[model samples]
Target: MFRWYQRAQVCYVYLSDVSSSVLEGDSPTSLRRKPAIRKSKWFTRGWTLQELIALARVEFFSKEWNSLGDKQSVLLTLHERTGIAVRALEGSPMTIFTIEERMLWAKGRETTREEDAAYSLLDIFDIYMPLIYSKR
Candidate 1:
């Protein structure tokens, strides 16, 4: 999936848990409420981290499918929301950053399945571990 993301022409991120109908207007109210976009659920998911980093160009959409912005347009917000280096968001090779820094990217992300937390990171570290659905 990580490799597929890297080779994709573009990835469209649908923020299903966020509504942009109120923020999409051109009025001053809407413009001032741009910060609302940062509260999207995508930022808290473990799997989306890989998708965000691997995809060269990501076009973000709201639950209503409203065009929020592309990766470049929201780079600063993405950095502030995720604490990911702007260079990484800009497609820098993962090897250039230390393992600690790379691991920090998934610091607060959550996975629904117990083993998924471990699974979510395999690609980021270039490891191939067999799936182990532990009962713990």
Candidate 2:
């Protein structure tokens, strides 16, 4: 149940049984009619690079993203082609990863969660670059 108040009149909008009429030429429009559909910007904020990668990972692993349907495909493609694991960026505040940090995590050197927390940007790049780029 939703109730809205006007300066002189109170209007009650319900999910069912609504009727109204409008008169032209400086006449007031009755409240009983369907309200005009006001459209505003739906999705304005865009995802950061890291967020995109993370989302790709979810779509890839879950195999739920669809190009024609509600499914997404870009994220999964990036993961499959690159062999890099993407982590969820939901709770994290930082949107973009430094070049070195991206190299390390994406390359797979920081296998354990603990190691990821301990490394600096340079350290991560050094430890993970070889593993990620290895021929095998």
> Candidate 2 on 35-135: residue-level lDDT in tens?
21011011111211222332312221111211111113233333333333433232122234465545544443232334333332323232333212224
Scored against the true structure, residue 133 in model 2 reaches a CA lDDT of 29
Assess candidate 1 and give its lDDT.
0.83
Identify the leading candidate in terms of TM-score: 1
How well is each residue in 32-89 modelled by candidate 1, as lDDT tens digits? Answer: 3347668887899888888888988999888888888888888888888998888888
Clash totals for all models, in order? 0, 8
Error of 1 at 72 (Å): 0.7
Q: TM-scores for all candidates? A: 0.86, 0.19
Where is the poorest 10-residue window by lDDT in model 2?
36-45
